[model samples]
Target chain A: MPIPDHVLVVDDDPDIRTLVGRLLEKNGFRVSKVADGKGLQQLLEKSQPDLIVLDLMLPDEDGLVLCRNLRSRSNVPVIILSARGEDMDRIIGLEMGADDYLGKPFHPRELLARVKSVLRRARSLPGDVQEQDANATYRFAGWMLDVPTRQLYSPKSKKIFLSGGEFALLRVFLNHPNRVLSRDQLLDFSHGREIEPFDRTIDMQVSRLRRRLGDDPKKPSLIKTVRSSGYVLAVRVDRGGESHGSDDSGPGD
Target chain B: MGVEPDKIVVQIDEDLAEIAPGYLENRRNDLKHLPLALAEGDFYNLRILGHRMKGSGAGYGFDGISEIGRAIEEAAKQENRQGVEQGIADLAAYLDRLEVIYA
Candidate 1:
């Protein structure tokens, strides 16, 4: 028998933890439950689960901080489950490196479908985002991005951390700099998925990426938004940078 | 003349049958906590419990509980004692009338 995928569910609510764990187990996945960030870190030490279902309102640490910490160390897929159902909350969760976000009171089947979709997408991706273009470095508008290390450095050598979503979006922008890419194209390129109807995922991603790049959203010089259409990376990009950016600070610095 | 309370039948997922009893029992226990929290003006604990109920109730086939939970949470935020009291009463009535059917 093929080994079932393992999933870690981190939620402070015992009822939620039990429900989600049981549901995943019934769906042929090995499931583990943790109530806080401390438990998450302890479990991560021994084994890396295939995916994680994290709650935003954790006791010891917020889910966003945990997701950022996970991104710095690994590319494990995360689906945030939170009670905060606002659009901004979902965008912020995505900005913190979550692959997907589902609010509390969600149907079990909906969460199941998302888990399957994310797992399938993760499998179809070329190894890992960090491994793809392992040795390539991208430069645009005096900013540097090292693909292998997933590091971004500003013109003045100040390091800025990009969440997984931000990094992928930025990479797409750098690859096709100075061109107007539609939302569908950007979503397909960055996420390898078809655009859902009325999806503002790409727009929110662009906003987050711009913030990471220090491009003001009010009047972004890079990643300029085209009204009623898409966005354009208005900078010239060069790929052959010998220097892999300079910053003494580590990830999440 | 004594009037009978209305029976509220909720059909829940059969997959949840094993755990739903314990979950419902916990909510029943909250009946005790709700009055104590209200009497002591422990709005924080009341808000936490209300938020949890709001987030979890509908998923478990208790939309009425979720509605009451939302009301309680909102009232606690505003520190409206009357609203919280009404919400607790509604929750008690609903739980008393609830009949869970696993489908």
Candidate 2:
């Protein structure tokens, strides 16, 4: 028999972990379950799983941070499971490089489908293709986004570093420059998730991203808020290798 | 029949305090049938509600409310009518204190 694809399930709740692990294992995937980020790290060291099923809530560390760390080092596919039904959670998860997001009280069958879909995508992408794409960096507003290394560069001051959320949110904004994106739309396009009512998590993330972009929320530039609507990228974005002609000029003249 | 001075003084967390009033108001509307359940001796349903209250109340950092929920669950399980009534009264008093805290 062929070796089954390995999957890592990270969740603090034993019931959920067991239920999910068993369901995946029964579906022919070799499964390993961990309770927290530390355990996940340990598991990763022991073996490279084909994909990861990660829970946003862990007893020791937030799953977002873990996802960010994982993305920085590897391109392993990740699916986030969050009890928070808010759309912001989904967006943030996707923004942080998660391949998919599933809310709690989810059907076991749905989770399996998502896992299969991500795996299929991963398999379809030829090995080293992501690395080659990453080498082709994009520059906008004096900021350079290194895709493979998963790092950002500030050309003016020569600074480099962007948290996972910052990188993902920036990617979405740059890709859709000058578009008025509602929080829900931002979360959906950026992370493949929805925003929950009465949740300000997305606003918090956007503020964080703005700080990285050197855009002040009080005296805004670059990413501007559309009062009672959403946000829009106010500057032009030029990907690397694109013509550096008139359209590719830097912002603020 | 009289209020117990020491009936679990539940304190609301600062984060939850701002929205507690609105949340409690909505809960009160949904909980209109709660008293009817208690009066009809539907301890099972009461226990279920108590369990939910225990989890969320504790999660939001209200230990006293969770304790009262636990007490209510225990009392209902034992079929202690007076204890159940006392638990309900304590819960109400805690809610009142929360209102005062927010006020």
Candidate 3:
């Protein structure tokens, strides 16, 4: 038999930590619960987990920063839990490299499916954002995307990191530039998971990308929102060396 | 397993708190501390305690405690002393009915 996946749940609320632990344990996942990010760091130093279920509003440090740092170091999946369904929170959480997001008051089953999906996705690379390949770098708009090392460099040649979500979105845009891609299409291309009922996480993620790429709200330079047809990236994508002559990738094909 | 000589059977009631308490004896230390905590205008502690109660009470098969806990959490949020007091009174009344085995 295969060994059960290990999951670290970090949340300030002890009741929630305990309840999530019980639920995950019942679902055949070995679970460990911690109160805050400090505890999370301590646990990580000793042993790595297959996945992390993180809470956004922690007592000491913010979870988004933690996710960014985690992604910078390893591809270990992080699923964020947020009580606030605010767009900013969702956008920032995903842009920070969380594999998935679950709002508060969610059924345990919802979380379970996400956990399984991410773990399964991590094991496979196709249609998955976190593909590890050396020498596969995509450079566009003075930002260099190092695919293998999972690092992004700024226009000034400084090494700036991109979250898993941000990297995935950027790759999707790089591959299909100068075209209007709908939110549903973006979700399917990047995360490849079903948008549960009324989830608008893709919109938030796009907002985060705009902010990070310094796309101005008024008279934007990089990615522009096309009235009612999602968003379009205007710049040409250079696969490290060669530039695509034509936008063969049509709007909706 | 015999009773000690010269030891008389005595019954007493005390304020206390509990965790998954099935009876008064298993009550938690909050039984005694909650009133004092409230009297000192410590709604923050009350809020934390109430949140714990609200989350765990129902799981432990104490829905009455959960209801009182909800009241305490909401009252603490607004810093409403009367609601907190009423919640404490309800909690005390319910606790009083929990029979404990002295042995």
Which candidate leads the pack in DockQ?
1
Cα lDDT for residue A125, model 3? 44
Q: Write the per-residue lDDT of candidate 3 for residues B1-103, one digit (tens) a residue.
A: 5554533323222211232233333235556767888989999988866765664454434556667877897899899999999988887776765443232
lDDT of 1 by residue, A1-253 (tens): 2246789999998988988998899999999999999999999998778899999988789889999999888878999998877899899999989999998787889999999999867645633543455678888778888877889999998889877778877777665555456787677676543224355588788887888888888877777776765887776677765322222111110
lDDT of candidate 3 over A172-204, digit per residue (tens): 777556656667667766765333324548777
Candidate 1 ranges beyond 4 A from true positions: A127-253, B1-5
TM-score of chain A of each: 0.53, 0.52, 0.51
Considering just chain B, what TM-score does every model have? 0.93, 0.68, 0.68
Model 1 lDDT, residue A38, Cα: 97
Candidate 1 per-residue C-alpha lDDT over B9-98 given as tens digits, one digit per residue, 9 for 90 to 100: 889999999999988998999899999999999999898888888878887878888788888989999999999999999998889898
Model 1 chain A poorest ten-residue lDDT run: A244-253
In candidate 2, which residue pairs get closer than 3 Å at backbone N, Cα or C atoms, i.e. clash? A86-A196, A87-A194, A87-A195, A87-A196, A88-A195, A134-A148
Candidate 3, which CAPRI tier? Answer: incorrect
- lDDT by residue (tens digit), candidate 2, A169-246: 666666555555668656655453223334536688788888887787787777777777677776656667662222
Clashes of each: 0, 6, 8
TM-scores for all candidates: the values are: 0.65, 0.40, 0.48
Which of the two candidates, 1 or 3, achieves a greater DockQ against the reference? 1
lDDT against true structure, model 3: 0.70
Highest TM-score: give the candidate number: 1
